[model samples]
Target: MNYPEFLSYDIALAACAALAVLITLLLLKAFALRHLQRLADSGRLHILRYAEQVVSSTRLPFFTGVALLAGVSQIKLSPMQDRWINYAWVVILVSQIALWGSRIISVAIGNAVARQRTADPATATHLLLAGLAGRILLWSTAALVMLDNLGFNITTLMASLGIGGIAVALAVQNILGDVFSSVSIALDKPFVIGDFIIVDNYMGTVEHVGLKTTRLRSLSGEQIVFSNAELLKCRIRNYRRMQERRVVFEFGIAYETPQQEVERLPQTLMEIVSADYLQTRFDRAHFKGYGESGLMFEVVYHVLDADYNVYMDIQQEINLALLTVLRERNVSFAYPRRMVHVTHLAEPQESAGQAGKLAA
Candidate 1:
C-alpha cells in the first residue's frame, strides 16, 4: 500500500487494521445481541437469555480498548509504555468480564425467583440476597485479578483485609448476626410469608421476612416486628405447617345426677364426636375427675383441618349438641351453690330453767 511521506506504511496499515477490527467487533456484537434477544424472548432455551444478558452488558469502552490494544501491539514503543498499555488492557478486560458476570448472576437469580415466587415467596426473597452476594464476590475477584496482572501483591493485600475485616465484623456484629439469621431462616424455612406463627408471646401472620427484621400482622390489627437474630433464638410455632389441630375440652354436669347417667356420659360423648368423623377423630372421652361443683368430663379429639375457623365451628356444634342432649336427658349443667339448714332447739336446758325460774 502506498502512504504519504510523513506516515509510514506500517503505521498506516496498523491504523486501518484497528479501525476495521473496531467496526467488525461492534457489528458482530449488535448482530449477536439482536439474535439472542429474539431467542431469549421465545423462552425455548434459557441459556440464550443468559448469553443475551452478557452480550448486552458489554460496554462500548471495552470495544474501543480492545481495538486500541490490538493496534498498539503492532507499533514500536518503549518497554515501560508497553507494560502500562498491557496493564490498561487487563483492567478493561477484567472489568467487562466482571460486568458480564454480574449480569449473568442477576438473570439466573431473577429466573429462579420467578419460578418460586408463587409457591415459595420466602425462597424467592432469599435468592435476591444470594445474587447480590454473588455479584459482590465476582467483582472482588475481578479486581484482584486486575491487580495481580498489574504487578500488585494480592496475597498480602488479602491478609491485610482479613485482619481489617475482623475488626469491621466485630464493629457491625449485630447487623452481621441478623444477616446471618436471615440466611438461616431462608435455608431452614421455619416460617414463610403468610404463615401464622407464634414466637414467644407474640402471634401473627408473617408479613415480611427481611435481612435484619421480620414483620408480622397480628390478629388484633397490630404490626409486630422482631429482629431476625432474636426471632431465630426463640421458639417458633408455625401453624401453617400444622396438618391437624388437637383439641382438649372439659365440662361438668351436676353431682346430683344419677350414677347410671354418669356412666353413660362417655358413650354419649363418643357418639357426639364420631358423628363428625369426617372432620374430627375422637381420641377419648372419660369422666375425668370430681370438680367442686360437678363431675368433670374431659374429651380429647383432633380436628382434621388445620384452619382455626373450622376448629371453632366444629367445637361450637359439639357444644350445642351437648346442651340439647343434656336437656332431653333431664340433666343440668353444674353451677356453684350451697345449701344451709336451720335447726330450732331449746336454747339450753340451763337457760330454759333460768327463764322458768324468773317467770315463776
Candidate 2:
C-alpha cells in the first residue's frame, strides 16, 4: 500500500504536538476561567469579571482550529492547502474578536442599565437598545473583515451593499422611520412609560414604548396605538413631568350682581381657593370681562399636586364652596339669556298726520 507523499514522520509529530497544544489550551482555559470566576466573585477586582466573561466565551472549536493552524504552519503542504488554512485562521481570529467585543458591549451596557433601572427606567430602556445596536455593528464589521481577509473584493461588495441597502431602505422606509423615531424618543425622553401624554385629540397613559408603535391606555378603557414617527411629529403634552397643575377656569355671574359684591369677587375667589383643605396656590382671580349674557370672571390657580384626580377633587371643593358663597351673597350663577328691548313704531300715515298737525 502506497501512502500519500505528505504523510511522513514529521507530519506525525506535528499531529501529536497539535493534540498536546489543544489539550493544554483547553486545560488552561478551564483553570484560568475558574480562577477568574473566584476572583470576580470575591468582588475585589471589578475588571476580572469582564475578563472572565471574555475568556469563558472562547469556543472549543476556535481553540481546536487555532491548535490545528499552529501545527500545520510547522508542516510543509501544497500552496492551496496553506492558503485555506490561513483563511480558516482568519475566520477563527475574527470570530473570537467579535465575541469578545460583543461580550464587552453587553457587560458595559448591562451595568449601565442596571444602575439606571430604578433611578431612570427610561434611560435603562434606551441603553438596552444601544447594546443591541452595538452588537449588530460589531458583528457586521467582523464579517466584513473576515471576508476581506479571505480575498473578497470588499470595496466592490460595500458599493453593492450600499445600493442594495438604499433599495431596502426605500422599501421599509416607514418602519425605519418609526424605529429611528423610537430611538429619538428614548434619547430625548419626550415621554416614557407611565407618563400621561396628550397628542392632538388623543390623551392616554403611555403603556408601552416600542420601536414601531407606542401603546397608550386611554381613559375610555381602549388601547391607543400610534406610530412612533407620527407621535414625535405631533405636539406631545407630558403631564407626568408637571410638578403642579395650573388650572384656568371661567365662570359668569348674573348681570344683575351687585357692583359692591363684584368689586369684592376677586378677594372672595382668592379666599375660596386658599381656604381649601387641598393644597392650592392662588395665582390670581379677576372680573375678566362682561360676557354676552353675564359678567365673566377668570380665575387661575395651581394645584400643588400633579395627580389629575387630586386636582379634580380640589376643583370640586372650590366649586361647591363658591356656589355656597354666591348663594349667601345673593349672587346668582349666569345662564344664557337674550333680552330684547322693543320700541313701537307708528305707521307712515300717523307720522304724516302728526307732521301736518304740527305745520297747521
Tell me, by TM-score, which candidate is best.
1
Candidate 1, overall lDDT? Answer: 0.89
- C-alpha lDDT values of all predictions: 0.89, 0.90
For model 1, residues 1-360, the per-residue Cα lDDT tens digits are: 444643586687678778888999999999999999998889999788789888888878888888888887787779999998889888988888888888889889889978876798778777877887898799999989998999989999999999999999999999999999988888888887788999999999987777889999999999999999999999899999899999999999999999999999999999998894449999999999999899999999999999999999999989988999999999999899787899976668888899999999
lDDT of 2 at 288: 94
After superposition, candidate 1 runs with Cα above 4 Å error:
1-111, 117-129, 138-157, 340-360
TM-scores, each model vs. reference: 0.63, 0.61
**Alpha-carbon shift of residue 69 in model 2 (angstroms):** 6.1
Candidate No. with top lDDT: 2
Give the RMSD in angstroms, all C-alphas superposed, for model 2: 8.9
